[model samples]
Target: MSNPTLDLIRAHGSCRRYRPDDVSNEMIESIVEAGQRASTSSNMQAYSVVAVTDAAKRAELARLCGQQKHIAQAPVFLAWCADLARLDRACQLRELEQSSEHVENFLVAAVDAAIVAQNAALAAQSLGLGICYIGSIRNNPREVIQLLELPRLVFPVTGMTIGWPEKPPRTRPRLGLEAVLHRERYNPNQDEALLAYDREMAATGIYEGRQVEIPGRPGEMEAYGWLEHSARRVAQPMRTFLREVLEEQGFLLK
Candidate 1:
């Protein structure tokens, strides 16, 4: 059976290079509408998307996003924000205190934003557009918040660059289903699967000639394979200040 949706998802890949063509406003609106149609937590829809088309703003955003040139070149840059500020305004209108300061609310907002952004990405893919998610926006969330004029109870979760691809990107590999799917109970014996996946990934030339910094060993370097690359990323604190930033945003107040 040919499942178009599954096929589309299976063929997904991040596109960094795009054509110089512009995405029509109508297409952008339709994509965002698809995003809005995603399931929301408690129907709160605690998320917002800011579309940046200005050249200067995109340049600034690219700098904030670890100086990624693709962000600046993309026709549309969408910042997906976990936004509870609107909910707070809604509470004020009803003369009720906002409860978005709790950890649960923050989780809900972040999840909502992620789900919505995925929906938008799928829609864009269906329209023959390519997209790449920029998680590096978290490297300096404070600056991104300031640049986007984000209020309290709102923070950028991720950004997406969308446009017509200059060329089809190579599909990246993923872990086997057995590695992630647990039936009756959680399976602890994952080493074999991990090792097998590591070999398979090593055969691919995707990370060839790339240098990766291992955690706890500052000057130490390693070949960029999936296992080592991912391990290094998880071994250290990528965003140590996120908790403090969330606290400043009135989240994680228990």
Candidate 2:
């Protein structure tokens, strides 16, 4: 089947380098409008996107996001947020109690935010713009909350940098369908698929000329394959403070 949308998705890659040219306001508005068209939980629309364009703010955001230069250089930096604050305010106006602190509510808001952000990314890509998602925005969640002036019941979910691409990047390899898809029931046997994918990725030179040393193991190293890289990533605690941050934001209360 010939499908332009699937083809575009398959060819998509994270854009780290971008041209100095700005994405026009009309395009940004269209992109965000596309995002707004995405389905929301109970039509609550619990997501908000903070568009940051100021040079000084971008620099601070880049610093907060682990010094990712692309964030500062991108023409647009959008801070996607899971927001229940507006719902709470709505409840207040009607003299109704707000249950925004529930874990289910948090999940709903986060999922809504992610779906909308992906829609916006796809819209930007369709317009010849490139985007890179910055999960490192959680590195300093408190700072991000303060910087964006997020109220209670609102939390920064992720950041995205969007701009005109300076150059096209090679499409990265992904796990085969067998590794991710199940017919009738869940499959627990993924070792074979994972190993095959690791080999395929290594052969593609995706992580070529890079050294990924095993933590706490000196002199005993192996090829930095996808399995090794991903294993190392999960071996240690990443974003351990997220729970605390969410709790502070009046969420995840079961």
Candidate 3:
């Protein structure tokens, strides 16, 4: 019942509610250390983290993230930044030419930032903390950048709201193993597998009951099924707020 590994991976789930308890400063540092331990490309290790505890800042961040109230509710909001600025500035301080101005270096930093952030999330979950990634952070990157005082060569890849859970959440069912794993190849049988998985999801009644504010009919990521909710997501072209924000932040993905 106390497998540390399962505590890290298997039991990990996104939790939005909080009990008003604060995450201790030491725990926050440990969680950050876990993030720093994540593998990086070429050991480049290019990333920075901005921990936002200010209520006003979190409220604005919540607004930027599709107005998700949890962003504001959580006692801590960590913004994982893909930062080449620090490296560049260090280079400049030594009167050396900057090498990370290229697209490859930029992408490398961004990808590494995401990897590390997930590492932190899992670490928090293992330490009895709840976390929910706010991908909508990209919707208004300029504002976030300004609020965080990020430099030009740095970008906020994503934000996560973390806190103690108010109540435990049930485990959600996953698709059969065959649906995802491959045998030394990339072959996929999409139609049959998806159909079967959809039915299984429906039978669980995960999406049957929910209150959705979107223009379309009712949908639920919390309930009737994961498949139908995913269907609704792809049914209409979702906003590319991330793309817009990246461009605004000078992420010329050439």
Candidate 4:
């Protein structure tokens, strides 16, 4: 009961190492065209992608994204933006005032951007290209805004690097469906499923070499598993300045 698309999706893995080949503009446009076909809320299409190919700019962007070498090496770096400025322009053209301050609007735009980027990623993969999503683009939002020349109501949601794969990363395991899927009503009791998945992931040795040490209690755990790694990630404070950055981008959380 599987098809090409489904098989492709299941086989998906992030490509961190890429060959030095370039992704042509024609190929990029075709991929984006596929993205443009993705469903959008109210057909608002509140997203824009900025493709950065300039070596210097890509280097700078890689630096801004915590020195991710893949981003610097990839031939193309796309900045997916939640763009409400175009909608605002539409209102201006109609001589009507547009309000982008609502939190709902912000959410809508972000969701739109993410959906489109996923479509684009699949399209690239279909063409035998590789991609890696870079959420670290939000690390220096203000500088990114300036570098990309994004106007008000436009926020960089994420970035993606696309190129020919030098080597593809191993397929990562996902949690069992029992942990996430529930019929009819919500099920809060999933400890057993979680623990089982933790054991399964531990067996794969995914975090064998790169284990995050739990602060104040280093080397307490003999074998680090998915639970411990994810717990550490969730416990840490991340992107606390996003609210202020969103405000500066003219998106009001209220």
Candidate 5:
């Protein structure tokens, strides 16, 4: 039940283990080429990527992600940056009154960076490489910027650590059709079916220790599930500084 494209994408999960196999410079160049081919916004291509393999740099990066060992161990880690700086410079040279100050331009560039990064991720997966998103790159944005030497108006949007998986994690169950895919306009809520789905998910052990970890949090339900896990995330201040950090990087620079 696998077509070429579907099978390729379905094969992706996350890789936290890797052998000592060193990825050659040629291979890294090819991977970058794969990513560069992704469609862009108005051909502006408002994104940049920095491939980090230096041991010292990787070590610093590990701490940025709360000491995630995979960051240091991965054969390659790519920092995907939303690069509005290049466009800004072009405007400066032309003495153009830059109007790209609104939040929409920043959002569009961020999406452009991500769409291309996903393309590279899928391509790597097809080549028997495993990739995991290191979303914590935003935890301390300026550190990442200084480490990568990103310019003004450019911000690190995300990180992708790639290597061969030492052991595969389960594909992880997704919310069933009725819960997610909606037709026509939209439904703000679907309570009963969602509860049933949550119950089924708990039986699958995905929420095994969730109740004990944050008893007062969202995922503390007797029927543990993904919703509970998501609740705990939003309950915290994890994403609180993103907008502020983006501002510091001159992202909304008018």
Candidate 6:
């Protein structure tokens, strides 16, 4: 029931601090090969990865991603892209009209990018490399597009920093299986599991001093947990310009 792969998967944790070391090109290619083995929608393979090691570019990327220092510290920064530009070329080769503007098409490409990136992540972990996924790559989408020289119909879905961990990474707790998994139909009544998880997470002190204060609320909270933190995140408007950016990238999202 237990194996190295499963152990690696369970041991997975995001590494923000990295030691100063270079990732070999051969190892990078091997990781990419693992990513390429991920399943794709209709074999369209609508994704691409840009591996950046240039010091200046990595600094700029770190700036674009809300100044995450790990990006600049890591030996390699990978920009995983949802790429339909190649699909457009394929249609041109066949002299056929391509339908890449639909929302469904965009979803397929985004999902493809995510799956491949996770495969690459696991591969890197297997090789004793640490990685941290940077969703803030979209903080300055247009600048990122320009910086990475991404063509139309190609969007950077996410980024990842890769290097040797400065120390052993800490594994964070996740919601209980009862909260996420249902037997058959979706179960809306999970308050019991939710409160239990809140207690479990509160004991870790991960959100200490980071509790969000909602406007119009009078008093400070006595207990802060995952639900409150997640609520604070969900309550805020994030990436509101993404629709416009997608349109500019040739994904009409119709």
TM-score for each model: 0.92, 0.94, 0.85, 0.94, 0.89, 0.95
The model with the greatest TM-score is 6
- Residue by residue across 1-254, what tens digits does model 6's lDDT show? 78998999999999999999999999999998999999999998999999999999999999999999999999999999999999899899999978988999999999999999999999999999999999999999999999999999999999999999999788888888998999999999999898888767877888774554444686654467877877779999999999999999999999
Using TM-score as the yardstick, the better of models 3 and 6 is 6
lDDT of 2: 0.91
Candidate 6 regions exceeding 4 Å error are 209-221
> Ten residues in a row with the worst lDDT in model 4?
206-215
Superior candidate under TM-score, 1 versus 2: 2
lDDT of each: 0.91, 0.91, 0.80, 0.92, 0.81, 0.92
* C-alpha RMSD values across all candidates: 3.2, 2.3, 4.6, 2.2, 3.0, 2.0
For each of the candidates, give the backbone clash count. 0, 0, 8, 0, 1, 0
Better of 2 and 4 by TM-score: 4
In model 1, residue pairs whose N, Cα or C atoms come closer than 3 Å (at least 3 residues apart or on different chains), thus clashing, are: none
| Candidate 4 residue 104 C-alpha distance from true site, Å | 0.3
**Candidate 2 regions off by >4 Å?**
209-222
Question: Whole-model lDDT for model 4 versus the true structure?
Answer: 0.92
- By summed lDDT, which 10 consecutive residues of candidate 6 come out lowest? 209-218
lDDT for residue 138 in candidate 2, whole number 0-100: 97
Flag regions of model 4 displaced more than 4 Å: 209-220
Sliding window of 10 residues with minimal summed lDDT for model 5: 212-221
Tell me the deviation in Å of residue 103 in model 6: 0.2
Model 6 accuracy (lDDT, Cα):
0.92
